[model samples]
Target: MEATQQGADVFFVLMGAILVFAMHAGFAFLEVGTVRHKNQVNALVKIIVDFAISTLAYFFVGYSVAYGVDFLVSAAVLDGSAEGSPFAKQGFDLVKFFFLLTFAAAIPAIISGGIAERAKFWSQAMATAVIVGLIYPFYEGIVWGGNFGLQDWLSESYGAAFNDFAGSIVVHAVGGWIALGAVVLLGQRKGRYTSDGRVVGVPPSSIPWLALGSWLLCVGWFGFNVMSAQSVEGVSGLVAMNSLLAMVGGILVALIVGKNDPGFIHNGALAGLVAVCAGSNVMHPIGSLLVGGAAGAIFVIFFNLCQNRWRIDDVLGVWPLHGLCGLWGGIACGIFGQEALGGLGGVAFMSQLIGSLAGAAYALAGGFAVYGALKLLVGIRLTPEEEAQGADLSIHKIGANPESEMAPR
Candidate 1:
C-alpha cells in the first residue's frame, strides 16, 4: 500500500507537469497571434527558448533557493527510498521539480508579451536567467518554501499565513510586474506613438490563432490549479468548480464590457481564470464568479487605460491581464475565502492585503533592478532599424510566413 500510494502521487504530479508544459505552447501562440506578422516567429521562439533557459536556471540554482533541495547527489541517493522517506520515493522529487519549473518559466513568458516588438533577444535571455534563478525563486521561497519564515511571521501576527493556493501573486503577479519594468525601460514600439500625441492601434494579426491560444491556456489551467494539490488525496472538487465558474464569469462580463470584441472576450476568460487561481480551493462558486467577473472587467478597463490613456505599450496588455488581475485575486482570496462571505474561511483581509501589496512592491523592485542593470550593461531593446525590420528577420533570419518572403514582388 505504501509503494502503491507513492506511485500514484508520482503519476499525478507528472501528469500535471505535462499539462502545465503544454501551457507554454499557449503562451507562445497567444503572443504569436497578437504581434504583427513580421514578429510572430520571434514570439514562438522566445517562449520555447526561455523555457529551456528557465529549466537550466531552476534545476541548477532556483529550486534550491526556493526549496533548499539540491539534485546534486547521485541517482541512487537522490531517490527518496535511499533515505527511508517518502520524498525519496520513485524520484518523485525530480518529477515535482519538473512541475514547479513550468511555473518558474512563466515569468519570462509573461515579460515576453510586454516587450514583444523591440526587446533584444540575447538581453531577454540573460534577463530570463536572472529572474528564474534569483528574483522569482526568492519570493517563491518565502511564500511556499519557508525560506525566510515570512509565512511564519504572517501566521503568528495575523492568525493565518499568506493563503495563495495557486500563486496569484507569486507567478502571475510577479511575471506581470517584472514585465512592466522591462516595457517601460524598453519604451514604446516604433510608430506606436506619434510625436504629436496621436495613438496608433497595432491590432492582432490572427484572431483564430489568438482564440486557439486562449483555449489551450483555459484547458491547461485546470492542471495549474487542481494539480497544485500535489497528491490525489489532497485534491478537491471545489477547486475545479471555482475555476470553471470564474472562467465563464470572466468571459461573460468581458463580452458585455468589451462590447463583443473577440480580443476582449478571449482575454476576459484568461482574466477570470487568473483571478480565481488563489482562492479556487477556498471560495464558494458564487464568490469565484464575482471574482472572475470583476477580473474580466478589470482587464478590459485597464488594458485600454494602459494602451491609450497611459501609452505604456504593453503588447498583450500583460500588466493588466496578469499583473492587475493577479493582484485582485490575492486580495479577493481574503474577501471571498472568508466564512462570512460564504467561503471555507481561515483567511484574513489584512493579511491578504499586506501580502499582496508586498508582492507588488517586491516584484516592481526586482523588475526595475534586473532590467535596469541589463539596460546599462548590455542594452535591452533592438535598435530602431532592427525594430523596423521586425524581430523575425533581424533576430532569427526567418519569417513566420516564409511563403510571403519568397514570393516575387
Candidate 2:
C-alpha cells in the first residue's frame, strides 16, 4: 500500500511538472508579445533568470516551509500531552517539492508583467530569491503546513483544513500582490501617462507573440487547475470540465465587454484561469464557470479603474487578474466549498477570507520593504536614456542588432 501510494504520488508530481513547465512558454509569449519589440529579448531573459532563482529558492527554503516538519511536532508544540513524530517523515517529499517548484516559477512571471519595460533585471532576480525562498514558503507553511499551533484552528474547524488545492491564493495571490508592490514603487513606465495626465496606450509590438502566449497559457492552465486532484475519480474529470467551462465563461464575458479589443479577450482568458485556480478542487462545473466569468468581469472593472481612474499603471494587468481574481477565489471558496471538505464549525468561509487577506498583506508589506530597500541601496530603475533605449542593452549585456540603436547611453 505504501509503495502504491508513493507511485501514485510520483505520477501526479510528474504530470504537474510537465504542466507547470509549459507555463514558461506561456509566460514567455505573454510577456514578450505584450511589451515593445525593443524589450523582447530583455523580457525573455527575465523569465529565464527568475525561473532559475526560483528553482534554487524552492529547493532550499520552500521545501522546508511547505512540507518540512511533521504535523505531530506542531501538535506537541501546542499541547504538551501530544507526542511528535519521531521519524520526521515528510508527506511525499518529492511530490511536494515539485509542486512548490511550479509555484515558485509562477510568482516571478506574475511580477515580470508589472515591471516589464523598465525594471532592473538584477533587482527582479534578487526578488525571486526573497519571494520563493522567504516570502512564499513562510505564508504557505502557515496555512498548509502540518504543524498545528500556527493554523490549528483551521484544522479544527475545517476537517482536512484551509484548502487551496491548486494555489489560487498561495501562488496567484502572492504573485499579484508582489507585482502590485513592485509597480507602485517602480512608478509608471515612461510615456505611460501624458503631460496632461491622460493615460497613453502602450500597444504590443508583435501580435503573433501576444496571441500565441495567451493560447499557450490557456493550454498550460489545465495542469495548473486539474492536476491538483491527483486522481482519476469522478472528481478529477469534473474539475477538468469545470476548468474548461470557466475558461469559456471568462472568454465570453471578456469578448462582450471588450467588443473590439482582442487584447481584452486575451487578458480575459488568463484572468479566468487565475480565478478558477483556487476553488477548482471542490466546486461544481457550473460553479467554476461562474467563478471564472466573474473573474473576467472583475478584470474589466478593476483593470480600468487602476489604469484610468486610479492612475496606477500595471503594464500587463497583473494586479487585476492575479490579485483581484485571487481575492475573488478566496471568497468563492467560502461560498462554494462543501462543509464536509471544510470540517466542523462552518467557518471555512471566514477562514478562507482571513487566510487570503493575510497572504495579501504579507506579500504587499514584504515586497515593499524588499523593493524599497533595494531601490535605495542599488537603484531599481534605469536612467532615462536607458529606458528609452530598452533594458535589453542597459540591464542585460545583450544589444539589439540594429546599428541605429547601438550607442550606449
Candidate 3:
C-alpha cells in the first residue's frame, strides 16, 4: 500500500507538471496574437527560451533558495532509495520539482508580454536568469518555503500564514510588478504614442490565436489549481468548481465592461483566473465568481489607464492583467475565504494584505535593480532602428510568415 500510494502521488504530480508546462504554449500564443505581425515570431521564441533558462536557473539555484533542497547528490539518492535520504520515496520529490518549476518559469512568460516589441533579447534573457535564480525565489522562500519566518510571523500575529494556494502573488503579481519596471525602463514602443501624447492603437495580429491561447490556459488551469494540492488525497473538487465559476465570471464581466472587445474578452478570462488562484480552494463558488468579476473589471480599467492615460505602453497590459488582479486575488483570499463570507475560513485579511503588498514591492524593486543595472551596463532596449525593424526580424532575422515575405520561388 505504501509503495502504491507513493507511485500514485508521483504520477499525479507528474501529470500536473505536464499540464502546467503546456501552459507555456498558452503564454506563447497569447503573446503572438497580441503583438503585431512584425513581432509575432519573437513572442513565440521568447517564452520557450525563457522556460529553458528558467529551468536551468531553478534547477541549479532557485529551487534551493526556495526549498533548501539540492540535487547535487547522485541519481540513486535523488530517487530516494538511498538510506537516510530526505526525498520522498518513488521519486515523488522529482516530480514535485518539475511541477514547481513550471510555476517558476511563468515569471519570464508573464514579463515577456509586457516588454514585447521593444526589449533587447539577450538582455531580457539575462534578466530571466537573475529573476528565476534569485529575485523570485527569495520571496518564494519566505512565503512558501518558510525561509525567513515571515509565514510564522504572519500566523502568530494575524491568525494564519499568508495563504496563496496557487501563487497569485508569488507568481502572477511578482511577474506583473516586475514587468512594470521593465516597461517603464524600456519606455514606450516607438510610435506607440505621438509627441503630443495621443494614443496610437496597435491592433492584435490574430484574434483566433488569442482565443486559442485563453482556451488552453483555461483548460490547463484546472491542473494548475487542483494539482497544487500535490497529493491525490489532498485534492478538492471545490477548487475545480471555483476555477470554472471564476473564469465564467471574468468572461461575462469583460464582455460587458469592455463592450464586446474580443481582446478584452479573452484577457478578461485570464484576469479572473489570476485572481481566483489564491482562494480557489477555500472560497465558495459564488465568492469566486465575484472575485473573478472584480478582476475582469480591474483588468479592463487599469489596462486602458496604463496604456492611454498613463502612456506606459505595456504591450500586452500584463501589469494590469497579472499584477493588479493578482494582488486583488491575494487580498480576496482573505475576505472570501472567511466563514462570514461563506468560505472555509482560517485566513486573515491583514496578513493577506501585507504579504501581497510585500511581494509586489519586492518584485518591483528587483525589476528595477536587475533591468536598471542591465540598462546602465549593457542596455535593455533595442535601438530605435531595431525597434522600427521589429523584434522578429531585428533579433531573429526572420518574420513569422517567412514564406509569405519571400520573392517568387
Candidate 4:
C-alpha cells in the first residue's frame, strides 16, 4: 500500500507537470498572435528558449534557493531508495521538482509578452537567467518555502500564513510587475506613439491563434490549480469549479466591458484565471465569479490606461492582465475565502494584502535592477533600424512565413 500510494502520487504530479509544461506553448502562441507578423517568430522562440534557460537556472540554483533542496546527490539517492535519503519514495520528489519548474519558467513567459517587439534577444536571455536563478526564487522561498520566516510572521501577526493556493502573487503578479519595469526601461516601441502622444494601434496578427492560445491555457489551468495540491488525497473539486466559474465570468465581463473586442475577450479569460488562482480552493463559486468579473473589468480598464492614457506601450498589456489582476486576486482571496463570505475560512486580509504588495515591490525592483544594469552595461533594446525590421528578421534572420516573404514582389 505504501509503494502503491507513492507511485500514484508520482504519476499525479508528473501529469500535472506535463500539463503545466504544455502551457508554455499557449504562452508562445498567445504572443505570436499578438505581435505583428514581422515579430511572431521571435515571440515563439523567446518563450521556448527562455524555458530552456529557466530550466538550467532553476535546476542548478533557483530550486535550492526556494526549497533548500539540491539534486547534487547520485541518481539512486535522488530516487529515494538510498538509506537516509530525504526524497520521497517512487521518485515523487523529482516529479514535484518538474511540476514546480514549470511554474518557475512562467516568469519569463509572462515578461516576454510585455517586451515583445523591442527587447534585445541575448540581453533578455541573460535577464531570464538572473531572474529565474535568483530574483524570483528569493520571494518564492519566503512565501511558499518558508525561507525567511515571513510566513510564520504573517501567521503569528495576522492569524494565517499568506495564502496563495496557486501563484496569483508569486508567479503572475511578480512576473507582471517585473515586466512593467522592463517595459518602462525599454521605453515605447518605436512608432507606437507619435511625438504629439497620439496612440497608433498595432493590431494583432491573428485572432484565431490568440483564441487557441486562450483555450489551451484554460484547459491546462485545471492542472495548474488542482494539481497544486501536489497529492491526490489533497485535491478538491472546489478548485476545479472555481476555476471554471471564474474563467467564464471573466469572458462574459470582458465581452461586455470591451464591447466584444476579441483580444480583450481572450485576455479577459486569462485575467480571471490569474485572479482566482489564489482563492480557488477556498472561495465559493459565486465569489469566484465575482472575482473573475472584477478581474475582467480590471484588465480592460488598465490595459487601455497603460496603452493610451499612460502611454506605457506594454505590447500585450501584460502588466494589466497579470500584474494588476493578480494583485486583486491575492487580496480578493482574503475577502472571498472568509466564512462570512461563504468561503472556507482561515485566511487573513491583511496578510494577503501585505504579502501581495511586497511581492509586487520586490519584482519591480528586481526588474529594474536586472534590466537596468543590462541596459547600462550592454543595452536591452533593439536599435531603431532593428525595431522597424521586426525581431524575426533582425534577431533570427528569418520571417515567420518565410515562403510568403520570398514570394515575387
Give the residue spans of candidate 1 off by over 4 A. Answer: 83-86
- Give the 10-residue window scoring lowest on summed lDDT in candidate 3: 190-199
Error of 2 at 173 (Å): 0.8
- Model 1: per-residue lDDT, tens digit, 375-394? 99999999999999999999
Give the TM-score (vs. native) of candidate 1. Answer: 0.98
TM-score of each: 0.98, 0.87, 0.99, 0.99
| Model 3: number of backbone collisions | 0
Which lDDT tens digits does candidate 2 get at residues 279-300?
7766777777788888888888
* Cα RMSD, each candidate: 1.2, 5.9, 0.7, 0.9
Looking at model 4, how many pairs of residues clash? 0
For all candidates in order, the CA lDDT equals: 0.93, 0.77, 0.94, 0.95
TM-score quality measure for candidate 3: 0.99
